[model samples]
Target: MSNIIEIKNITKEFKVLNRREGLKGSLKDLFSRDYKIVRAVDNISMNITQGEIVGYLGPNGAGKSTTIKMMTGILEPTSGEILVDGCIPYKNRTRNAQNIGVVFGQRTQLWWALPLVESFKILKDIYGVTDKDYKDMLELYQSLVDIEPLLHKPVRQMSLGQRTLSDILAAFLHNPKIVFLDEPTIGLDVSMKAKIRTLIHALNKEKNTTVILTTHDMGDVDALCRRIVIIDKGKMLYDNDIEHLKGFFGYYRTLKIRVSGSLSETAEKIAAEFPEFSVSANDEWISVLVDEAKSTVMDVLSQLQKTYKIRDMQLEEISTEEVIKKIYEEGVK
Candidate 1:
């Protein structure tokens, strides 16, 4: 399959002004600014194929947002290239916007006072949709999202869940080939988040739309994306299948045990022994971190049981969230 999006050696930099202590210093900075160039997005490259849903992840100020902004034509790159459907996003923004849709979680593209249907109608006109295409697109989304009841309600009056559903529908109304969703499930309840995930999956399967999802929610990543690209401090850390990413860091496992009393000493000893694993404790409950490659969960539990009375025990595979956390914490050195 052809790549729907290609980013090559992309970098973005911003001039940050240094300001000294007080109100007087703030005023001085306005006229005589001492600027430091901050690299918001360092040299990065990735190719996203058609009909694929990619999870883009990073901590705060990790340049995930800066990369997305550059891809969507909201910000021009300081250097390098971004191509969406074979057109340069920054240089040919109008042409690029016609083929792509973007949703920033903190912002809404729909009109607040208008009803959901009205907002979609405005978008349909904006994109110059034909009557037949408009009807088919609306029907397809209404069935996929089940937004019939929410459509008549004004956007401001609807709940967050309702508005989010409507907003996603609005983005797809133009039948864009690719969509960029930034925190699409942010601030949603568990049920609502599930619903959105289902809708996204259905959209990809039925319409073959390429999706680039940027989210802090690991649940979203686990549910929706087969491939994930991780970024930190403006650098691309890893880009591969989810399973491969987990195996690459093979330093995670969960150890749960019930021991006599608090077992604080044992917990402290275990933590001290394995500095790589983080440890936690509760009354009569001791949990130790186990690196699968270093020590199996069974081995750790058996050793602990010999040292202390163990009533109950369980082992869990490390979660994607924990793996990502370890990667960032350890700096992939």
Candidate 2:
């Protein structure tokens, strides 16, 4: 498949005034050019192909949203190029909108008082979706999800999950070539989250819509994305398949143990003993992410048994969230 979205050396900068502490400073700031330029997105470049679901991940203020805004034509980049389906998003926003769909978190595209179907109808007209295509989309939704009952309900009366579901349906009603979903499953129950993930996957498969999903939830990334792009502090970090990214920390495993003493002190002691491993403590457990390649679990256990008493311990495979956390804290090692 051809690339549906192309972003090259994209940079977004914002100038924020350096405010003074008092009213005098605030007054000076209004007329003064003494401000700082914050780079929200820095020299990031990536291409997304058609029919692919990519997880764009980062913590808050990590420039994930800024990049999405540039792609969706809501904000123009300070430098570099962004082409969505062959059109410059900021330059040809109208044409770009026609070929792409968007669903931001908790922001309903549907009319607040309108029924789900009514919103769909308005979108159909706005996007110029044909009667045949519209019917086909509804049929696809029925096969993929049992949302027929909620179609007639007003968006205002719908639960958070139901409204989000309806919004997704409306986005795909036009059968756009690309869809940008920012935190699609935010604030949803586990079952609802699963449904939304399945819906997005099915839609991408059935309609071949390229999807760019920005989410903090690892479950959403694991379930819906084959590839992921991670950025932090406006800098591109990792862009690869989930398996390949996990390979970076393949030798690592979590060792969770119940310690009798103060968790912080125990954790500090453990860290001092094993300077090589990443050790952290919580109220319940002192979790140590051990790189088994350097030292075996039994070796570490034997060494630890001499000083601190380990009441209960469990070994777990390193999770996606853990690996990403490590990356964020220490960068790619």
Candidate 3:
């Protein structure tokens, strides 16, 4: 597959004003000139292939937003290059806008007072979409998002979930080959979130849309993306297949145990004997974090049963979110 987006050594910086103290600080910030350069996006590079859905994840203020802004032509990079659909996003703003779609979860891009259909009409005019193409897109989006019930409803009267779904439809009305979604499912109910995820999957499969999704929702990443690129502290930490990343942290396992009696010191001793395991207890229940490669859950359970009566036991694979959290807490040093 051809690359749809190529970002090469891109970096962005912001000038932050320095303030002194109290009332003087406010006055000094206005007149006294002192500034510090904050590097929002450190040098980063990656290629997004056409028709691929990529999950772009990072902690807050980690340059995920800055990088997306640079890619969408909302902000210019201080250094390096960003190419979307073979065009420089910042240099060719008009062309880039026509070729790409963007949805921001925190804000609405549709006309507030207009009916949903009217908003679509306005977008059709803005993008100069042909009559036949507009009709086809409208039909497809209606089926995908089921917006017929909301078509005549004014934007101001619609719920946040409704408005968000409408915004997503508007972004893709032009049938842009590349779409950028920033927290698209944030703050939505489970059913609505599932609807949006289904829509995204359908669009990628049917239209061959290349999607770049930035979200804090692990569910979104798990459901929609095959590949993930994670960044932290303005640096890329991991960029590879999601399964591969999960396997790297696969050694960590969780063992949930239900005990007939209180967890004893002997149980603690056995857990302590395993150098790679960590144990935590609450009331009649005990949870153990074990290194599956070094000691299996069965080993822990077998020792516990030999010493005490076992009520119930279950083992679970470590979640992706927990693995990522560990990575963030302890950098790849």
TM-score of each: 0.95, 0.93, 0.92
Tens digit of lDDT per residue, candidate 3, span 1-333? Answer: 889999999888899987788997898688867889999888899999999999999888888998988998989999999989898888999999999999988688999999999998999999999999999988888778667899999989998888888888888889998999999999999999999899989988988999999998988998999999988877888889988877776577788787764577645865776556777776666778877777777887787778667687778788878777777787555
Quote the lDDT for 147 in model 1.
76
Error of model 3, residue 319, in angstroms: 1.9
Q: Backbone collision count in every prediction?
A: 0, 0, 0
Off by over 4 Å in 3: 260-275, 280-285
How well is each residue in 1-333 modelled by candidate 1, as lDDT tens digits?
999899999999999888778999888988975899999999999999999999999898999989988888889999999888998888888888999888866578899999888988889888998989989987888777777888899989888887777778888788889999999999999999999999989888888999999998999999999999989999999899999877776657788887766478777877886677778888666777777888787777776767678888877788899888877777676
Which stretches of model 1 miss by more than 4 angstroms?
273-276, 282-284
User: lDDT for each of the candidates?
Assistant: 0.86, 0.90, 0.86
lDDT of 1: 0.86
